[model samples]
Target: MNDSLQVIPLRHVDAERMMELISALVSSAGSGQAQGGNNQLKVIADTSSDRLLVKGSPEMIAKVQEMVNQLDTTPTRRLSGLRVFRLKYASAGHIADMLRGLLANQSINSAGATSTLESASLNDASSTGAAINNAASDSLGSSAAAVSTSSTSGTSTGVGGRPFSIIADETQNAVIVNAAPELMFEIEDAVNQLDSRRAQVLIQAAIVEVSGDDATQLGVQWALGNANSGYGVVNFNNVGASATTLAAAALAGTSTAGISAAASSIAGALIGIGDSRKDSQGNTEFYGAILQALDSSTSANLLSMPSILTLDNEKASILVGQNVPFVTGSFTTSGNNSNNPFQTIDRQDIGINLNVIPHIGDNGTVRLEVSQEVSSVVPGSTGNASGLITNKSLINTTILADDQQTIALGGLMRDNTTTRQQKVPGLGNVPIIGRLFRSDNDSTQKSNLIIFLQPTILRDGGAVASVTERKFNQMRVLQLVIDKNGTIKQLPLSGTEGWSGNVSADYELMPLNPLIPKRDQAPKSTSQGFTRVDSPNSGITTYPLNR
Candidate 1:
């Protein structure tokens, strides 16, 4: 009748097992009195909170406490919960595949205390099979991640002992893993590291056309500077090279070599090739060399400025031109003898194009695979024209440089000559005697294509925010200048109060600034802390329990 109730919270051991063990001990240690069964120690397992409610005499409760203390160590049981890791930047499927490759060779020890593997064999990942419960798959909270049943073999894999399974929830953008708790922590750590936001690269480029004389000047300026690495190579591409073929060749560490690069009427001759960077001595070069040389009599003109922003290890491209239709093929059907010919028309893009793929290094260096082209339809080329006259300038190369470094590509030139003679109508037909009244004019001009490129890296969210804010504010300023409304100057651009020196969850789904529209994305209260999530997007969203 005189028993005390003790509530004990557990971290490792399951509450049910703990109670069973203590019940036996209490029964044998209790005094042999004529008390009813109700007098015995009552131990109830609280699996909901992983706690134990124990009622017994003071002495019995003391024993139970001692036993609980002895058993409450870190659990080594080789069973991991179905843990879901929501990814931010990295793809969930990619991360899951990487982890599976890492854990493919893991084996169970003789004692079965832990999962052991020196290294995982990637070859086995494709062939390995696993078994997951259908109920567990169907019960997965996120509808985006519908679980696989027992028939789904590759979702879980094991050589022996308890199987380890990993599934990628593409809709949820999450990686779900079921493994030992000890192994789970290691996998979770890797997920956290891999799921981080990727760095971004912004590339700026300018294409210029200069006279042949200025091209020589630029070539000299480009070659004169001593490279810090002291390693350099020059490449020349053949005329009329396709963009796809040129890029493939460059990626394979080779060049298009079927035809020799002779006097190209289509693509101009290459004038200069070199890296252009600011020197410690502060000598104005690069653009200065091109413009100053053009300032004299070189007749240099900037054609276009193309800029693109992209993630690391990704490709960015910009193209400015017109699409001209050309006949690719002509077909005649035998069934129709009506002299009717069917023609296939293809639209060819003719203009300036710049494409680059950037691979970032940890040392603030970037390796760029660049492909540039300038193509134009000759003065009077039309649809379905045969052997149409076209001009083109193409360059494909890879360069490695420090972040925010500039490089110059030039020397592509085209040559054209014109001869005009004006003569008296009847007198010009008089052969030799007409020469006295006839005037002859002959002129030749040369144009060289020059390209300058610069790549900059944005390492963190703060850096991204700063760059984005600059662009946003620039537009805002432009808007203010054009607006005639009285509130133009008073319009608030102060929505950036979210960003700080340290950016953690600084970017939100809905704008904090009152100017932008806000959605009702806040979580609704439920019996389960956050059992229901109402988000249109697949990415992770944070919700406070109190709300």
Candidate 2:
């Protein structure tokens, strides 16, 4: 590492802010306004006296400076003229890798030698011998079956095995590589590439408890089946399992006519009494398994429970009245809530404190505290509402309250709107130069800003499992760009340089697809269900999902 190699970490907020600045810079640079004209607001030749002065949008620079400032509690002198490397825009693979790693490490101990790092890139990486050896035999066979046993001696390129190499340029601080796998496969392979002997040694060094559905059931299954194929197991297929289903006779409301009529209004009010199974004919079977468990008098009583620190007796009484049983870990023990309303799961596996109030006799009724800084107030026409509204701001306001899946950055013909605020650069805001450069210029759009960052080192302080890099410098603007407005617009970051759509297609990253499926619920039409057809070659039933 070089002595001047400055390191920086960016949070969600910093990324957003940096993006605003980059967009502004790109817009300004593309516009002819950046040229030295009568519009006194021309671009600045320089900002600081540093020989290697770094320049970027104000928000981008500010965010980087802010992190450095906060982390610098040391007696080091004030740092200045530092080049800002802003990682504003990231690919889907990047985002997915980050989220996956964060969610994967949430539960259990992540402090030992076996513990993985919290950061990763989403690009496919080259495969090593150990990685190929770690994959499940099925998945491995699905990819490269020619891979045979790796040798324990020198060179180790035995029969049927592929000799992969990762060349690190110690002089240039870069890596040269041949073809690499996709990001998802890279992550899958990297973990599998570790030496079993080395892994066991590290596991022994760190007495960490690795327990969970993924780490236990899936882990054991994958580990046991393919000792030669080293790999991690991840699955979300728990759709039709018998252990969790209920019986029809156990259903509460499907009984006698006269007695059923009397209980008709509240018949379906019992818990664990829902249709648990769905047949091929589309019929559902609800059982009373959950309801029976709750009706028993000897079962755990809510009255015997003590009130939580954040909840008063009034709130605690509601839990008893509602007869709501605590539900804990579902997807995995790592993301479980232990049925406590006061704790909600975070992507990082940490529990965030929350105050929940349930409605009487309702299992789904829940009202979480919206206010981080809660206060008390009265309610009336001229007075305060029943509850105080005080100063409360929500995080990630970019996402809708009803559904967080949608994005709301801007619309076409975007004018001065409160929602579509563009971040400007500090130097671009100077008196004479400010007017010449608007952060949202849309004339020339061929320029692009590149960003780079140091890779994450694992906690074990050993070699990283995987690596990825993007050619940000190669990013070129296209003549036609779909702006936030959803309309085609042209823009430049510095001046009147416009993109002519002449950019080579080879420079573009892979086209992206919608992360989530277009529709959530099955279509009302029966034809929307799976269609079973006899195999052309074999007489077997096969159901293909509706495309």
Candidate 3:
């Protein structure tokens, strides 16, 4: 057999179905011609572009082509036309129901065939009954035809047709119909008549005070009900960190340079928190981490510290302080044997350093790392020599959160401010009998800083509206009142005698208000209680305020 390659182009057929058909043909041919071997025939289908390539002996290629031709010639139902229409704000189920109602009893002509209206009607009734029964059975989970009939009789008022199929494509937000050309036109008309106007989705965000007298100063209040849209809000709090011991170790016989170097390293780590890149929301992973760490604290002692204010001339620093030991030695010249003074060493200063780094994830998760170091000098037992004590703590973690969701990082407790009052500079230092000339006052303000982060995911109006409507229905009426005016008021009703009391009095006996016109000049009252009056000179129409 001579080797040959052939390409077959197919149209009006799904590539997937074509591939399956070819596979079946190959299997059958292979069984009949076992001598050809399993690999004798090779077929490649480029489903991406919908084409089939065959490589084999000429005999095999010809056999494949014959099968394709036969398959192509087989008769099948042909769609006269197709119409695709979007349901917009409508659901697929609703469009399906509408189509069922509009297209019921419509005649469907098969390919190269026709049907009379009478026959179509008869078929429609049977098909309608079957469809209703099927729907009822599926919904009710009952097999009894009588049950289905009774359940559907009230709801299934329209006839059904077998000539067309309605397909709801939810992903595409559209409905597609396959029917005769005339039927397609009718479907299009019916769909156009359905309401497709989409409602607006409104998303709102605010930082609200959950509690405290200062709550009013915090979040912005909004009336979302009056607007015909949906709404959402996100609340976030400040970020904070707690002071925790990072490391505790004694440093003896270690050079001062070595201790200083370690302190510098720890400081670098803490200050490096600012190196993280900010996300679209202008938040860095470091900040997020800090917020998370602060939030995870279970004890008040582990809370974050309040922020400090620095004067313009002074620079703010995260490296709080580092204390180094001082050493001195002296010789005594006048004592017996001209001996040196007793050698002694004293160490008392402590050192502390803190560092925090936060990393933000793409999915709004935050990873935080915190490093702290503390050091102190301990006196040696033998002489004036001193040893160093150091402590360090490090934390790293990740947390997941979305918009309107709050993540607590940490808390801080400290004296936020100090106030000092003194008399005139010269008199402030007076003592004893001079006490009357001087006065002094000192005060410390303590505060706790908590970090709260709330993220709000902004979405398209459609989605926002849908969510807002479904979740905030109760607010709608309230919003209307809010929109009318910033406040709600109750006004006294006029002409309430009949409503307040059981008796109705004649107008002739009732006292007239000086502000109102006389009864004869007033507009005639209609049965509906509205009085329309016309001015002959001004040609202006007026109505009485009181019904």
Candidate 4:
């Protein structure tokens, strides 16, 4: 075996795949030379630098070097400077369209124009035009030879008296630009700017049922919460209590600024809401903490906590329910042999659906268009026989709020009433006394629906990582029941300490948004709702959420 090593640099061939083939051959060579001695060849590939490191006998090393040269064949290249730009975030089709528009809008210089970075030439366009005309003429003529077409389409005249063509590859999200070298430089720059990652928004939506005194406290503005009204909220943007009620138009979603004038009305009455308002201990707190305190009681019933992540200016939708099938229309087909009834059944989702499109503003605020609908299938109604009877509450509103600030939506009210009667079997036939044998009962119930929305802007990777870690810690605790509630043991996740379920009390409450302000630490709280509870690092238990 040779004591020294040999280096083989490759250009055209891929180092990783070549290494696999070489390794197999080296193993075979070692097996063949087992009786002789340790002639084992070691092949190491450095994919980054496209080089191979090998240590073997002189004869084996020379043979391997020869194989490398033979396989590393130089491929042909295009005479034209054509390039394909792979985009990470932007759509290739959209970018190509934008480039075409830009190039088309470019003004041509009449005074013996020398093609510059931003400018293109009209003279260069004639060449591409001639090519197109030639292809057309060839196809029209009677010839045996095939008339080939160019993939490049002349979007507009480009730099250096040449016409450039842009083609978008949707499957690979890449844009292929064929143009003069000068124009290619400018095109690359534009693509780089557009291909960068856009900002993302994390929307957390909580739907709760408000009742008791809480419902009364939220009056007109509360109802306006679900639907957009002429009036906005009174206590807007989680600020301290103020007198004049702000109109909903104040935060109406628009490209420009919101309405400054608002008619005076008392909107916010409930106290201790918003992140700006501190708790009893004077610690910065999230309004969700106050809601959690109410969640334990019948005052507030948390219907759902649905969250989604979406790109800026992109729409995100969430549907938390089931699809129900109902007959839409039916037709009977008559034939001499047999008759059959055909029914057209359509399925509709009966649950909570919240759609939101968030636009991240430069001023640390987010404009959102929220469309929320909550519906259920009604029972024992006239429409229920043929089609499904549905009770639905839908609201579509556009509003602007501060970053990480909770937007309150309420005002949807529902009333349910029921009457039941119990009667005797046979003895109840005795006229007036029969009434005494039967018992009657009546009941009426009312509930209000309120939605809370909070949007967090993720500007970079750090913010994403922080949120990821926070969510991981907040996962529900798991328990291992070796049997049916017998010999139970707690399960623990690897890499994570025994701590489970006490996700981030402060992290969840504090703003994770980098664009907005946040608290240094979570406010001190006596309520165990936000308080951290020490639990053994038991195994994870996946339990089905109760309906």
Kindly list the per-residue Cα lDDT of model 2 for residues 330-430, writing each as its tens digit.
34334555743343332211111112221211232222222111111112322432322221111211111111111222212212212111223573466
Q: How many backbone clashes does candidate 2 have?
A: 47
Q: Candidate 2 regions off by >4 Å?
A: 1-142, 146-154, 158-161, 176-392, 397-547
Candidate 4 backbone overlaps, count = 19
Superposed Cα RMSD, model 4: 28.1
**Per-residue CA lDDT of candidate 3, range 1-547, in tens?**
5668888876545456776888887887553235565347777788665567888777778887887767653234344455667676666545654554345432233221112111111133222211221111111122321221223232321122224455556456676566544355446667877634432212121111111111111111111111123222111121111111101110222234532343342211222111123347543222111112111111222332322222211222344455564444445567567665663455444443433333334564433343333333433533543434443322233344544466664444455333333233564455653332332222334445444433233235665554544343333223322323354322223323222432222121121233456654454553434345344642323433232
Question: Per-residue CA lDDT of candidate 1, range 262-350, in tens?
Answer: 21222333332322344586431221110011111245465687778899988888889988777778888687577787898888888
Worst 10 residues of 1 by lDDT: 287-296
TM-score of candidate 3 relative to the true fold:
0.27
Pitting candidate 1 against candidate 3, the one with the higher TM-score is 1
What ranking emerges by TM-score with the best candidate at the front?
Answer: 1, 4, 3, 2
Q: Residue 6 CA error for candidate 3 (Å)?
A: 1.1
Model 1: runs farther than 4 Å from truth?
1-80, 105-157, 160-162, 211-300, 332-340, 413-439, 472-547
What residue runs in model 3 are displaced by over 4 Å at the alpha carbon?
14-16, 29-40, 57-59, 70-414, 424-428, 453-547
For model 4, give the 10-residue run with minimal summed lDDT: 288-297
Error at 513, model 4, angstroms? 25
